[model samples]
Target: MFKLGLLIILAAIVVCAQSIPFLEESNTVAECLASNNITQAEFQELIERSSEEDDLENTERRYKCFVHCLAKKGNLLDSNGYLDVEKIDQIEPLTEDLREVLYDCKKMHDDEQYLCEYAFKMVTCLTDNLEQSDEVTEAEKNTNKLNE
Candidate 1:
């Protein structure tokens, strides 16, 4: 069941990614740019003007590297090339749904682990789930107000 659920959600993320390709670009790209003494915004400017396919591919690779940079820097990635769930729990207040999302996202991994893709996918999944939780919390508050 969990595998099926993760597959569905990952498919959805990929579909959305097709429409906005840059949404697939993880923070790792930004981290990689720092080596060139470039800021995230500067990298964005550079990528935006690039028209060559090789350039895009190169940038994608850089983005992947950036993701690794972020995970390593934040201690988010474990030695196994997977997310350190313990570190995440220590750093963030995640609800049950968010934890589930994280678990599901984490299940999609390669031998190399592609921590950049994992981190970005996990980050986006968590952000979406957390926003839903916030909405539900706000709705509950409104309901309580009405009852009172």
Candidate 2:
């Protein structure tokens, strides 16, 4: 009876975790792109540009608007163009550290004017913070192994 109960609980956890939606749903992405009148090639170019560290500072308005569209679709942005941290906290598969980083980034960009710019800044900030966090984590693990 104990083993059966444990198995059932584990199975339920797996099912719940699997059901958690990805931050961007495919249908939502398509809808947002269509609404924004963005072609896949243009979107790909934006993605490539955003990936380049130096290009982030010069993101085009169209790219920023597309980001805003995605955030709006996901209900991640509040009425004032700021990130709704509460909504962000509910996204599953996000580590506690990542959540903390997100909250910090939201506060950091709290005064952004336009919805498009706010969304774009938040995305960039989160990406940079997460990358830094991963580097720090990796360094810590290496140090611990060395000490061991």
Candidate 3:
């Protein structure tokens, strides 16, 4: 239950409605949750807990599997249980920089043997990169404005 919630929260953090189309679909999330045997209440609780700093590292294996389920459903994972970089590059809202980061993250985890851990690590990598990317972009914009 906790893992399910953590996966959902991680998904939300890395790919909110503006970025990932599948995540915006309630049916998809519901299906993944049901398949994973995670109760809606537990999912909600985990989402709330996601705001805490330590949830990601403490997330359970079930939650990692839940993330894998979501990745499969979203067509983010290839037949080998690795991220499909080609498909990810086609996502309309993802900027080239973000796509590059995704590719790098995938490469970093290429040795993962478990699909669940792979998916979870991918999410974690994405969240960390996205946050850093946002900070960098904001800083660049501020610098550009000052220079102008």
Candidate 2 lDDT over 37-114, as tens digits, reads 877777655445443334455545765676676667666656776667666556555567766876798788888877
Candidates 1 and 2: which is better by lDDT?
A: 2
Model 2 steric clash pairs:
none
Reference-based TM-score, model 3: 0.80
Per-residue lDDT tens digits of candidate 3, residues 49-95?
A: 66563546666777777778777777766789887867665665566
TM-scores of all predicted structures: 0.52, 0.72, 0.80
Which RMSD values do the candidates have, in order?
10.8, 12.1, 3.8
* TM-score, prediction 1: 0.52
**Descending-TM-score candidate ranking:** 3, 2, 1
Candidate 1: misplaced stretches above 4 Å?
1-32, 36-40, 43-61, 90-98, 108-113
> Candidates' lDDT values, in order?
0.51, 0.59, 0.72
- Model 1: per-residue Cα lDDT over 69-126, one tens digit each: 5556555667776766666666655556656766766675434456656554554555
